[model samples]
Target: MKPLHRLLALALAVSMPGGVALAADLRVMTSGGFTAAYQRLGPQFAAASDNTLSTVLGPSMGKAPQAIPNRLQRGEPADVVIMVGYALDELIRQGKVAADSRVELADSRIGLVVRAGEPKPDISTTAALKKTLLAARSVAYSDSASGVYVERQLFEKLGIQAQLAPRGTMIERIPVASVVAKGDYQVGLQQVAELLPVPGVTFAGKLPEDVQSVTRFAAGIPTGAQHPAEARQLLDYLASPQVQGTVQATGLDSVPR
Candidate 1:
């Protein structure tokens, strides 16, 4: 997305009213990865539409009570869900979300984090990354999309599953970087956006492209939404080109044009 196009997106969003005559209250459930950027842009959308957003934070998929799917299953009301694309697809498949409302917001790639002032390890290449993993005393990854990929796929690809198994920890309900920050882990692996915002951590860099897991962050209107009109408008504001800069600034890649 380019600046001119983003401006046009903003212009169209401002001109269009999706049918709500006045401000609306929307209940939104969001997961990690996109949370930082959403917090930054949520206010902008509210200012543009005078709509109020009530937000709940959770993972896209997990057994935890705060997980979006679990929250919905427990009868929580939600007008919108911002989470992993595949997780949203599952909701649509189950008829919990409107199929036509899916929209890709951004892509987040896994990155490495070390406690602030710690030696940043070399994970700039596949071989280097494998070596770094082998050398680490403790490794932490989230229990979300990126971590799942690393746990079930990435280590298998590197042929170090058994060796790294004991060393790697699947951190749940909190940022993986938090453990690294506390010196509980030597290395943290998670989405760049999730890692960058945590203090006392130094981001080494993204995993080498071939070994990376790119999780697509997306948004959709859930079934039985109280404010469907406002939810769609809010989605438009989020995916608009106007916010691409902020998206990148938060360590996310804009969805493909």
Candidate 2:
């Protein structure tokens, strides 16, 4: 080989891996409920892998269970999606997400919140929770999954559905704890994981054993993802023990079994 050609070949070989590494970015579309935990993990993942992550956070609007699907259907770019378990399954059934890429990350249970410095109320039983709800002058909750469940089923069962319907407030996007903290409501209800991050609010406790609602969260690579391997690595990092303490601090329990 000519001397110039030999030097060019050596340079190309040296640069190829760097080019491949620079070609990808992990695009993640995740629900707002998981935002706190992801905020901690996303940076660590990026630093360790030399890959960039772009995260879009919000509840699935309109007809989609996750924002990623709605974006994907419209030709948006997404490498991975993190959302409630059942929602991710729906995406898999539609062939938008890789079935084998699905991973259960954590389970978030619903809980009650009060303003910081206020006395926490007893919610250790279904009957006690019902009494507490009815007695509260005002109550706030999300417009998301836990809130919907409370509105559609739990409140009715407690026999205060009518009263709550007239006065209960449903918050969207913003954490319910913020509402309670501002004195807009006497109590707030949302995922335990969500409640922990808001300033000026205190976690009361999870719902009683018999009536608790736990939402399981999972992640999956989109079927046509440009960075499938990186997406898997991010998911693995989320489920690893190194991230477990951060997950717990955010009030989410690692998925059991």
Candidate 3:
């Protein structure tokens, strides 16, 4: 019975629970805009919960509209997802995420940036902002949600669509701040949170009052998440008051609700 005893020992070893080898790994899929916040919080979450977080940073292109849905349809594994509130709601309706697991984290507003030491231009009103855009040699913006909104709706509303069409450029994958830093464009426009992180660029300010658009960011657990409890804990930590200050310092507003 020596061989049978050996087989039982192997089974015991493999089936053992509460071991480091068997610890849960929470896989998270997030947009590039949240990179800085996650970099700070991921390690804290791991240390507090004794669970591992594996993050996948996706491009900002259609962050809410297309990229997320495409990734879910492609069968990407994600225990948790962090993105715009409207997008998360859509995913909930599509049955990709747990409807009850949603939690609002922060709010981001669109802003402009110019190379450090450059003279800051006025964009305090719709008319003034339009003039600034027209006067710029070449403007750079993202290919993501904010950029799309600006290009499709705001510019047309401002009556300068024709002027920017020929010379303006939309950057994808890379941050708009980088484009401004390289002198490829006279000004960069993106979420305030995104523009603040890149070096060599100084924030001008958020868009004017009437035209300003704020995107609410949130986190949700996938419906079939293997570590739902751990995911909830991480979400709680992110939305806590302690984390909210960091969120605000990054140019995002604290979620009011």
Per-model CA lDDT versus the true structure: 0.90, 0.80, 0.78
Candidate 2 accuracy as lDDT: 0.80
Give the number of the best model, judged by TM-score: 1
User: TM-score per candidate, in order?
Assistant: 0.93, 0.84, 0.84
Tens digits of per-residue lDDT, candidate 2, 77-141, equal: 78988888887898899999999999999988899999998888889888889988988999898
Off by over 4 Å in 3: 1-23, 60-66
The TM-score, computed over Cα atoms with residue i paired to residue i, of candidate 2 is 0.84
Question: Across residues 17-39, which tens digit of lDDT does each residue of candidate 3 receive?
Answer: 54222347999888756667777
Candidate 1 TM-score, true structure as reference: 0.93
- The order by descending TM-score is 1, 2, 3
Of candidates 3 and 2, the better by lDDT: 2
- Residue 188 miss distance in model 2 (angstroms): 1.0
* Number of the candidate with higher TM-score, 1 or 3: 1
